[model samples]
Structures are given as structure tokens and as C-alpha cells.
Target: MLTGQQYKDSLKDGRKVYFQGELIEDLETVPALAAPLNEVASGYDKYFNADPDAINPVTMAPMSAADLRDRIPVITEMDLLTNTTYQSLMTLSVAAARLEAHVPEVVPRIRAYVEQARKDDIRITECITDAKGNRSLAPSKQEDPDSYVRVVERRPDGVVIRGAKLHISAAAFGHDLMVMPTKAMKPGEEDYSIAACIPANSPGVHMTNTTYHPTGRDPRDFPVSSHRSIPDSMVIFDDVFVPAERIFLDGQTAHAAVFAHSLGLWERLGGVSFMVEQADELVGLASLIAEANGTAKISHVREKIDEMMIHATLLRAGLEAALAHANSTPEGYFYPDDMYTNVTKYQGASQFNTMVKHLHDIAGGAVVTAPSMLDFDNPELRPYLEKYMSTGSTVSGEYRTKLFHAIRDTTADSFGGWHFVTNLQSGGGLFAQRLVTRKNYDLERARALALKAAGLSGA
Candidate 1:
């Protein structure tokens, strides 16, 4: 990873891409991209450079080695599927043991870029998810349009890109981008399968930004919602040129799949790690809310809290499982098991939804109707809301505030309220997980076992 200064310098690599109508350059000054750079910068300094090396000295080198690159993106997409499935299972078990060591390597590289961008005030984002045209069809089979991003022309030193990458988070806010395959591409989808990092200003690259308002971003500043609300952009790359060094995968469908799967495994682990913590936070809030509502001692409500606690435990178990069993590949760094990682994510999805539902259930209608703190602070409504919202028990004013604010944020803002939707969708969405899961699991063996016991059929 480059230093913060170097990272900022790297953002200036001359690349042309269309944004709006005219070409834009030097993203540091882009008005629309300022806040995001700020947010990313804050995350980097605190998280990335916390260690002496500004990277994880203990585990980074071992984890950040070029080993993962050795897994060719050109491998058969079919094989990539198997490896992804396997890796997911392994990672879910003990994600921390395997991944924590590498944070030094991963964080600094990502952080350095983000930090410098923060310092220079340049915009940058990553694009991986494809337009994926028709849900039922593959990237190559989409009708009437380009559902997936692909290469349109091949230059000796670079390649021209076309099509759109959908649901690309932070697209509009970036000055340059790192694009890669969202999933394995099928044969004949070679153009779409090429993966590379290109400038956001690459020729013909356009972004349709989204806003997940209310809870997403700072709503006072952004107001769109649901695929909107300034969430992401539909990155349209039209004949954009990508030089070779910036190219990570080119028509190497097989290797692309491996790379994607590997990334997916790690992403699943990390995502679950964060999501689990989020759920725990909600659960803790729920308890406080219950106490304020004079329902803390209720048997059923306590039971729900217990269930929520179990979710955290299970989530940690999966994370630890992934880490405990991780191994290093020729790529030098480590990758977790597919089965455990997927299981962690899968279970997480199910449990998180379940947990949230209980939160809504326990919270009654109050979660949605609680008085805003602002309103409660008002002179007139303060008396009324504080009186009505309060349980009139032994709860203090501070305790009541804590309870009300808990539900308010969970159901309020895009970032705060839509956590479930984001978690379910961000990591390839729920159904996509199922698609990989079915491919990864050995259904035949299970079927054989059932048949043997029933004497109906056998291999």
C-alpha cells in the first residue's frame, strides 16, 4: 500500500471517462463527492494506521502477500464455483483467526488510498456488482441491453469498456474506481468477464447515483431512497480505456471466477462480523426500550432477548470457525473455508431478519411512532411527549431518552433503519447466496443417505 501522500497521487493517473456530459478531472475538488471522501478518510486513519506499520504488523504481511493473485481469474468458471463454495464454508467457522492477521495488509492499502483521497479531497470508490440484466439469465444472455459490464474493444496496451455495473456503492462519489467481476461469468461472456480497476473519469464511464435517505448518509443533505437516496451509482463504462497494469483480469473467465469467489468468501466473513455486531447493538437497545416500557421483566420479552443473544454467539462461532481453520495458499495470504463462511452469512441473514422482526414485535408500534428527540426537546411537545412516551415507572428521563432513541434510529434513517435491506442485498443479495449454496453443496450424497434409510433408491 502506498503512503497517504502516494495514495492521493495515485488518484491522478490520467484516465478519461464520461460523467454527466463534459469530462471531469482532479476529483479532489468535486462538490458532489466531498462528504463521502471525508467519511472514508475518517475510517482509514483510525482503522488502517492504528498499528506501527500503519498496517497490521502482526498478521498483514502473511495475509497481504500476492498469494491470492496466483489463483488465476482465467480458471474455468465451473471450477471457480466449487472453490468459492468450499471457501465460504471454511471462513464462517473462525473468520477472525484467518482474517485478523491480514487486516494490516488489507487495511493499509485500502486506507492509504482512502486517506490520501481524504487529504486531497478526491473521490474514489469500488465497483464489483454487475448489472446482471435478467435475474433468470446469465450475463451473456440478457435481452435488449447490456446487463453486465464488458470489454468493447481491445487495445494493445489497454481495453475499451462498455455496459453498466449496477448497485455499485459509492460510484458517483469516486474519482477513480476498482472494478471486478461480481460473480463467475459463463463461456461467451469473455468481454463482460474482464476485471480491472479504472479511473472514474475513464472515457465513457457515467454514474447514476442513488440515495437511501432518512437513515442512509446524512439525510439532511441527501433525500433519495431505495436504490436511491445517494447510495450507489449505475457505473456505465462506454468505450473506456483500461491500461494493462490496471487490469487484474482479462477474458480469463476461469481465473475471474476464482478471484470473485475468494473475494466473496472474505467479504461474507467481514460483512457477517459487522452485521452481527449491529444486531447485538439493536438487541441491547431493545432491552433498554423494554425496561423503559415497564416490560423488562416479562417472561416472553426476556426470552426474545435470550434468542437475540444466541444470535451473537452463533455469529461469533462462525467467525471463529472461519479463522481457526484458515490456510495459506500459494498466494501467500490466507483464505477461509467456504462452507463455514457461507453458513455464517446464510445463518446471519436468517437470524438477523428474525431478530429484527422480534424487535419490531417487542417494540410494538412504538418503534415507528416514538417521538423524535428534537420534538421531545421542544418546550410545548416536551411536556406532552415526555409524559405520554414515558412508562411512569421508576425510569429516569435519561433512560426514557435512551429507549426512544434506540427504536428511532433502527426504524428511522437509511443507514440506521435499512440495515436489514442493506445486509441482505449488499453481499450479492439473499437469492444469489442460495444460487452459490446449491452449487457448492453435495445434494447427491444427502439424497443417497435418505434413500438408503428408506430403501426407496440408492446410488
Candidate 2:
């Protein structure tokens, strides 16, 4: 297994990585990316340190029937799912199915990819979303056919691809890029149906990263934001070559949508898992902030906290139900129950804004207006700031303001904005989930039950 430093060293391979207008030569040395890089390293550590019972001792894969299952819960019930580990696992599952949907000749490619990834402990970023120049036109109909990643040249030994995938999480930090089509294609649009795995450092594969990083803040002031974040990037493929062994889908237009469909389900499951963690954090914050503000007994505060509990409870129930009824696909990969996963994601996302608003309302304007820790360190202003910042007699001004700063970092800052938008839009938004729920639900059974209740079963 690759150690944290070993994983970091592997990124030195000559791939072009740019952030904030400057090309980054080495990720390990960059201060701006340090936190996110550490997060990725920790994910590697988890795989190495995972208990043998929960993971395969020899292969380092999860022991669950759902291959690549998020093992955060398996190791310690306390750890939250890390993006790199969970997402790489999700991509593995998705890539496995892409080949399973293809002809028998293409099936061995996915098995080989999985074996290599597990053997090397490679991190992967699933690259799906294309630049998609025009919304109304399909890939072949668009003025720019290169809007989506496609096969530009086909050689006997390999295929050359060119395009860009946007908002790819951890693309720069990962070892492999699981390239897949974002949308389905028609019979004539075979070029857009391509799916393959390319080494992140492969020639012509470039990554330009963009992410929210809170700078120059004491860890006490921005606890969560100061650590544990992943960088999202636009991964550009400029005539990158994929060997025959790495190509899962070439021109199979009929099965083009399989990658997206499979990944969507797995991604939503990841969303649900993370929401459980978020809900727990939000609840703890609400309780502590309420106590610190001396509003613990207020009826409205009590009601809002109860509402938060309801959201958390229902989402957790959905996750459990999904696991209880998880279904296995033809490829032998297990996915959470579709209806339950969709409802969990949709409701959790729908409630996110409200949860933030409630935390802000309970904590008051201090969440946004809290003075920087720098002022607290000023010898002259420290005394005066401390005197005015305290709320209850027992609450220290430093502690109170620090809590408020943490709140701002979570709910009022750029990081908070990212959390809100990603939570709602990450799994294709609420409407997409609703569509899945409607399609998967047993509506006919419900109608039959209703007819029986109304004494019209025979009619």
C-alpha cells in the first residue's frame, strides 16, 4: 500500500496542474493546497490502516458485498466519509458496470483496471461533466463537437481523446482519471459515447484547480474550514492516448448512459452518508450555541431544534432502509435502494438552507460579525474586546467569539456558500431525485391498495 508521503511523491510526475493563474509544480510544497492535500493523504492512510475484518487483508478493498463501500463506518463509527476514498470507490463501481454493459470482449478491461487500482492503491477522480458548449444541441449537433470528450483518433494499440471535464473533485490529487460520458448519445454520436481510464499524469492530461480555502486564520477560529477540504478542478484532455487495456467503452452508444446512471446512484449514496455527518454537526452546533447564548429554554429555539432533529432522523432512516434493501446489478455490484437514496438526498438537500438559517438565527449576528482572532491577540484591544464579546457570565469572550468564527466559517463564509450550492446541486438537484423516486416507486401497488380501500378493486 502507498503511504501518505509516497502518494504525495507520485504526483511529481510531469502532469500540468494550475491553480489561481499559476502552474503548480509540486502539490506537497504549496501552502494554498496544503489542507486539501492533507485530506487526500488521510484518505490513503485510512486504506492502509483499515482493520483487516472490514477490508481485505491482501487487496485492501472493502469487505462489504457492495465492493468499494464507504468503510468510514466500518473502522470507527466516528469518522466521516472522506471524498477521495468514497469517490474513488464509487468510480470503481461505476467503471465496473460500464464494461459489464458492453460486449464480452470489453468485460476484462474493467477487471484489469480494478486489479491495478487495488494493487497500487490508486486514487481516482471520476471525470464526467463536459464543457458541453451548448445546452440545446447534442454532441454531434453542436458547432463544437469537441465539447464532450471523444475519440479523435483510433490506433490498433490505443485511442486518442480530447476534451475537458469540469468540476472534477480531487482530479489534481488523484492518481487516475475515470473518464466517462456525461450524457447518453444517439446512434450517429458514437464519438461522445467513449468511456475510459487515463492516468492523471498521462501526457496531455492537464488539471486546473479551483476551490475555497480559508487563509490566515487560527485553527481555533475556523476549525472545520482550516482542515479537510477537497480541490475541484477542470481536467483537460488534449489528444490523450488511452491504451486498449484502459479503454472500457469505445463506440458503444447504446450503453453510453450506463456510466452516468451508475455513478449517479453511488454519488447520491455518498451525499446521504455525508448528510448524516452534517446533520450531526449542525445539531451539536445548535445545542452549544443555544447554551452559550443563554437561549436554551426558549420555545421557538426548542421548536427549531426539534425540526432539525426530524430532518436528521428521517434522513438517517432512509439511509438504513437503502442499505437494508440494497440491490445487486447484473455486474454483481450492489447499490443502495434507489427510491430510498433519492428521497434521502432530496430531503436532506431541501432542508440544508433551512438548517443553516436556523443555526444563524439561533446564534445571532455574532456568527457573521465576530471579530478576527487577530484583534483578540492585540495587547491593547484584547481587554476591551473581551469585555464586550462575552454573553453569559460563564462564557469566556475568547471562546464565545471563537465559536462564532467557526459558525461563520461554516454558514456565512465562501466555504458555507460552496456547501450550500453543492449539497443542493451535487446529485443533479431535487428535481432529478424526484424523477428517480417517481420512476422507481411502486405506484401501481399503491393504486391497487387505494382501489381496494375504496371498494372498487373489481371495477
Candidate 3:
């Protein structure tokens, strides 16, 4: 619901953070992180602000003055399509906001500003994870004072925050960032139990430029990792202001995860949906690579491609099942099936890794050691690399190498490095998904069915 501009202006006040030992003054205007920030802003613009008809559909029947203000949007296209998009983005925005809130440089006040956003628009990002420095020691057990962002000042108008937030995305360019306990906060750890929205350009804020891929590779031989990116960062918040209105539940350790889980349904569904769409592309891309290399006719390649297709299709079916069996909650939101979403996510994560590896197998060693496309154009080596690199007939050997290199950049180094890691970390870990699935198991229903089949209970 929040526009890109509204999101931008809200972050005037600075929050505290450290990156490379220096503070980031203007996050939105920064060069390295600017594109992704703008990408998120542009996505927001497509929502209720400009393309309501495309996103949210409503009847435009002729009515008196009383009805003019009440209409949400007119149903220009089919109502189903409109609702479908809005719901899809509703899920996406939830995820986006969660992603935005983590970077210290993005939002001014982490909590108060976001409450204002709820009244105004969809300004949500995941302050999902802390640096988790050791991955061995827990949040409360971290070594550094700045390891986990904590409250340092509680003013009359707002609470001041200190420490750093980590591995947050779009926080450098979001209107509001959602800050919450990275994991469940305990009673003794209430200081870390927070779920608030803050503006992007807050005072005392800072962010570091962290990338695990070819973030800015050029197009001539553009690296593939640069194309399909999932950005992540560690945000530091040092004594930042979070006004009262923006505070949802501070130090309520019991409810920290609950508050986070409350808004999670839309995002979980959103994650599943994005992976489903991307999986389709991944499968297609794999097929194209196989075909381009003449291995399309091979039975092993065919089976591998089939496996990718099956995984992708099952993910789609999972999304539909979640949608079909959605349940309403007191929060006025509809939640999709957690089991199905988790199943889709778990399989999707593992399958994506598998698909990339299979692609490498089909692509041969050239997927990694292939000469850079730039080398092909070099007068000295151009003829040589191209002369020997041919794999099939259609596109030149250089072209084939280009395609395979793209795959390598993605599959080679951690699936686009930070991006793949970000996806794994996005909606909690794969382990977390397994736990949720276990919690959602309908054991009583299974027991009842078993008893009925055994004639121990009435049918």
C-alpha cells in the first residue's frame, strides 16, 4: 500500500549502524545498493498506487455520491485475475517488508514508523536474522556488544536502539523496515524481542555493502549470478529512535515469535509462489541448455529434466492446495496451509540445488572452466577459444559457453552465492520448515481414520 516516495521520505531520521568501520549517510542514493532498492520501490508502485485494477479488482457499477469514496477499485479485467494478483502481492509485500527492515541504513525508527505504514500502506520487510556471528553461540550469547541490535535509549517520544541487524535485504532502500527478534526471544532476552517498522534514512543508522556474487558484472559476457540475485546484508542499529506508535510489542518475548508468525502466512505463501514461478524458469533454462548442447536426446538428461519438471509441478500444486484450504484468523487475514507451504519450500530448496548440479553434469566442465565471453572476443584468443569450444550446431561454441557460464555462476558458487543463501534464510531455515511441518501433523485425524478402519470406532 505504501508508495516508493512515501517509503523514501519516512527514513529522514538516522539510525545507528556500522559497515566497513564507517556510517552510510544516504542508503537510497547509494550506487552499489541503489538498483535493488529502486527495484523494490518500483514493485510497490505497481500495487494500489498505480495499478489497482491490475492488482485489486472491484465492481464499478454506477452509484450515488455515497458509493464513490467506498469503491476500492473497478474490475476492468476479470475479477478472479485481479483478486489473484492482489493476493499474490499481498504475500509478496509481506515478504518484502520483512526483507527491508533488517538493514540499519533503511529505516529511521524501526517500530513507530511501520505502525504508521499499516495505517498508510504495505511497508514490511523481514528483520529476520541477526548476524548470528558464530552460528555456534546463540543471540544472547554473542561476544560483541553490537552482535545483536538492542535498545540503548527509551525517550518519551520513542525508544532508542543500539547494536546491529544482519543479513537483511532491501533495507537499504525501503520505506519501512520490520524489526523483530531473529529467533524466539526468551524472557531474559526481552530487549531483543521487538516487532516494529522504521523509516529508511534514520539517524545513527549504517549498512555495509555485502555481496556473495558478481553483483555488477557487465552484459557483453554478463555473469549469470548477476542476473538472478537474492541480495542480503548485515545491518547495524546503534541507539536509534523508535516512537511509541510504531511499537507493536517490545520485550514481549512470549509474543515475539507470535507477532512474527501472525504476519507470516501471507509471506510463506508468497515464498512458495515465487519459488514455483522461478522453478518453472529453472526447468526451462535447464532444457534450453541441454538442447543447445545436443544432450537433449540423451536419456539421462531427459530423466534429469523430467525430475526438475516434476519438482516444479509439485510446487505449483502445493500452492494451490494451500490456497484452496486457507483458513481465516482473528487478524482479518487468511492463512494458507503451513504444511503444504513447508513441503513445497523444503523440496524446492533441495530440488533447486539438485537442478543446478544436474545442469552442470549436462553442461560438462565448460560450465565452470569455460573461457569468459570477453575472452572469445579478444583478437588473440577469440579464434582459439571459439575454435575449440563447440559443443553442438545451432549457436556457436562461444554462445554455448556463454550459456553454460551463466549456469556456473549460479550453480557454481553457492547458487549465486548470497542469493541462494538468502533464499534458504528467507522464510526461516529448511530445518525450521521441517519443525513447522511436524507441528502441523494431523495425528489425531490419522488415529481416528486408523481406528475406523480397524472397526474400533464408528465410521
Better structure of 1 and 2 per TM-score: 2
Q: Summarize candidate 2's per-residue lDDT along 31-79 as a digit string, tens digits.
A: 6577777766765666675443243232333334454345435432311
lDDT of 3 by residue, 13-123 (tens): 564423345665555544444444454455455554453323212211213323322222221112222222333234333433443444323233433343333445543
Sorted on lDDT, best first, the list reads 2, 3, 1
Instruction: Give candidate 3's whole-model lDDT.
Output: 0.59
Clashing pairs in 2: none
How much lDDT does candidate 1 score? 0.57
Residue 102 lDDT (model 2) = 49
Query: Using TM-score as the measure, which candidate wins?
Result: 2
Candidates ranked, most accurate by TM-score first: 2, 3, 1
Candidates 1 and 3 compared by TM-score, better number: 3
| CA lDDT, candidate 2, residue 381 | 94
Q: 228, model 1: CA deviation in Å?
A: 16
Q: What is the lDDT of residue 118 in candidate 2?
A: 64
TM-scores of the models, in the given order? 0.71, 0.90, 0.74
